[model samples]
Target: MASLPNRKIAAAVVREDAAHRQRLLDRAFALAFKGLVYAQIWEDPVVDMEALAIAPGHRVATIASGGCNVFSYLTDDPAEIVAVDLNTAHVALNNLKRVAILHLPDYAHFRRFFADADDAANIADYRTFVAPHLDETSRRYWEGRDLVGRRRINGFARGLYKRGLLGGFIGLAHLVARLHRIDLGEFLAAKTVEEQRAIFDSKFAPFFDRKLIRWITDQRSSLFGLGIPPAQYDALADGKPMADVLRARLEKLACDFPLDDNYFAWQAFGRGYGKGVAAPLPPYLQEVNYAAVKARAERVTMLHANMTDMLAASDAASFDRYVFLDAQDWMSDAQLAALWAEVTRTARAGARVLFRTAAEPSLLPGRLPDALLDRWEYRAEESRDYTRRDRSAIYGGVHLYTLKAD
Candidate 1:
């Protein structure tokens, strides 16, 4: 697509010699379930639910990730939702939630399916419980016959969680921890915030912030293990001391938000959070939304496409809100303009768009046409509050804007 000058922004040069678009399922299937990714039902507090909380009749579209936010958004009574992602492992994880949330009968079973997900019962649970409701691809993904983990939702059972690039990162982390004479198991067990902080600030802080440790991890090759593309690393390195910026971000993660509620922080520090062998749960799991997730599960419809492309296929001005997440960082300027054109085309009047980025801004003024940016109102204060409140602490900042319905 010989698009536009804005396309320059989309041309994010990645430093990936090893990882390319592989067949998504097999890649995910083969990647052993190592517990690096969150697999629970908690929603991220960074997403401004109030922005997305349109009238019950409105529709929504968002990146599904592990499916936590999908279910969480459903609580707002959107007429329908389409959650999309490019990662197959992420898709499979969402499929797993689809079956469990919509059909598993009750929250207790739900709890076991996710909270105690590593339990022995999950094998039969997959075959007899969640398997049938899954789509053909998803159904094939869970059947015990070909799975690596005959029991561990097969994701955990097959060691698939341990095998992916992210899993390898966890393994590397464990090795580094061992070398330091630190037990991750002990850190995860810390019952008090003081205990967690004490260990993190003293033991983990040096690991992330020191020059030597920083030098190694900041390299293009080292980050590939975590599935970070060269482009992402380049974006991270944008005219700044990359490691210093990241260290500051991690420190914010440790100090800016409460540990108990910020599960994404757990992913970086402890590897996983929530119950049941650490499924990729979201922040909403902390309380009342548990039942809400169960009840709202049926309302969601999932898809496989780019966020803007998928929405482009829909009726214009149909969706009341948009959750682009961090995908825009992968986009060039023209792609963003094209995507926003779709967003502006299909987004209802007064619709809100929420997203995150490695850098700390709305990202439109530089890349997007002035007229379009003019129509939206950036809730700078709200963005500041939500971004600061982001318990994940992993991202740099959260940005919010309201598209003028007029």
Candidate 2:
């Protein structure tokens, strides 16, 4: 996997002044992402689309974590979308989604395969329809077995959404909540924001009050399942108690959006999109955009490489939009500068870049060179607007920047 370098880079970010402490933190992050991290992306596609304002003439380069947003971007009808990731598992998964979208007979089967993911028939569908069409790398990944001895593809038949690193983390959260006599799933019955808040205050808020739960959350390794590196944990948990931050985020997840349309809430509370609830499905799975995504599936290209390397090899002014997806939080000052240098070189006029942060402010000012950072104008007002509307409710900030005209 090309992730070793990323792991190394991540490891190096922890200051060595602390000696043993920093090294231990580095190892944890390196080991955490050795396998599949996110079964689905956590970013809100609606907010991303609004921020990027993608047009048919634009070419986009985005990190392909779980690949949901890559397909969602297709709805905007961009000229090209290049999905890149250092994690080979994620790269393979993106390829699988692209191929599945292209090869699935219709929207119904696609929904069955992904949204209603636990049906055993999906195994047959995969073998009969999706598997043969997948590239060798993706085929090998899906066909491969985990520590439990089931092939990864069987996860679809068993509940694809509940199988990855994030899935396991949510499962743990559920178990802990159950131990406290709280049924997290009950939050899904909320019809209005008030009802949602009431349910959360009555049932969910108490889960965080437990000392055991707070201790577990305090540990950085506990968040590895969410693909959060140690550096990100430091940023997220800075001055506040980790449990408090998590409680606030979970509160937002449960109470800020209507349960009817927020698939993220469905995933968090109901585990698997409530079996047949198609209305809350991700944008790609939704019926209205299904045909359009299928038609444009071929336009996506999945690459197994770091974003910096990918951008370095590309033609100058080749791309119009970039989606960093909280990756900047994992980088060092030097690494951030190198990345923005390439981004500045490769971006076309009016190019837009979007990213999320574990912290409230953008990381560019102190970390990136002033000259490089000055080349783009930060859309602070728009970022704040979109951040409020982001249904995922996980990130601290959502940011957008556009290139300054020469």
Candidate 3:
């Protein structure tokens, strides 16, 4: 079969060389990304909302990763949200989620399908309620056979949280920990951040020092499951050993936030969200925000296309908010300039752009032209604060920029 347009876009951004080794690695990463990558997005939507300052009547444009943040943004009642992605699976996932919210009988049914995410009854629910309303393209994707010949929608019945590329990576990490006689689950048992720190020091911290583990992490291909391309891996490493960087980031994830409220930690250590009703969830998944999200679900537009292309086709000054979700790290300088040119042209007065970086510094300064770069005022201090507070703990920095007054 010919490559999908979205997949082709992914190739264009990722395949940066023709050398045999480099070409092989790039092809492998693209293939891994072709299917579902993030069953749940790794970025913290709470931080995104706060930095974006999403207000009623704002037009928001974002990259649709796992569709978690897109759904979470609905609670803010934006006038419109255009979620564009170069992953067909993510596009289908986003469409499936919005349709589920619109057609599922109630919040209970919705919660059971997504939050619990492991019961076989979810298949019946999908068939009876969600599948009918889902766009035909998405329906085909969900109903399609996987490499193992099982239907993709069956993921909900078999621990949806444990199915995608990120999920598989986490599972492998857990297995590696098991080999080291460390149970990552011990961290999740902590009742306080103090206890979380203690557990990490005792059980998890030492695992990173093992020669075998360090060697595995040193390989660029080892990180493909986490969606880190070669260029992104270099940025993330920033001259430090990959093992050291991962350990520090994992420490933040394990100890910086309370166990009961940090869903990112839960996903990291527990392999899924906690089952309790009070377990932290993305805003859209919380019962308190259910009505608002459902009511605003229709406002979201899911597109399987490049984010820059989406902006290029949009009217000037049409969007007041943009979220790129670390995708700029994958772009060449020319690609970054092209993307920002569209962003600058399409942004409304006082518009805000939010994104994360694999490294500590914003990637735009020397890359984009001085003329275009000067149009936006970088929120340097606030971005550092946002990076500190971001619960995801995976990214090195979270940057925000607002368009300067014309």
Candidate 3 Cα deviation (angstroms), residue 254: 0.4
Q: What tens digits encode model 3's per-residue C-alpha lDDT throughout 1-406?
A: 5388535755555555546787677777777888899889989999999999899999999999999999999888899999998888898889989999999999999998888888899999999998878888999999998788979999999898898889999999999888888888877778878998888888878888889989999999999889898778989999999999999999999888888779999888888889979999988899999999999999999998888889999999999999999999988888899999999999999899999999999999999999899999999999999999999999999999999997
Which residue pairs in candidate 2 collide? none
- Candidate 1 wrong stretches, greater than 4 Å: 1-43, 144-152, 156-164, 189-195, 209-212, 225-227, 274-287
Separately for all candidates shown, the number of backbone clashes (residues 3 or more apart, or on different chains) is 48, 0, 0
TM-score of 2: 0.96
Winner of 1 and 2 under lDDT: 2
Candidate 1 scores a C-alpha RMSD against the true structure in Å of: 6.0
lDDT of 1: 0.63
**Against the true structure, what is each candidate's TM-score?**
0.81, 0.96, 0.98
Tens-digit lDDT string for candidate 1 (161-268): 344456557668778877877666566566667776787788766776556677786665555554444455556566676667766766776665555656665665
Preferred candidate (lDDT higher): 2 or 3: 3
lDDT (C-alpha, whole model) for all candidates: 0.63, 0.86, 0.90
Better of 1 and 3 by lDDT: 3
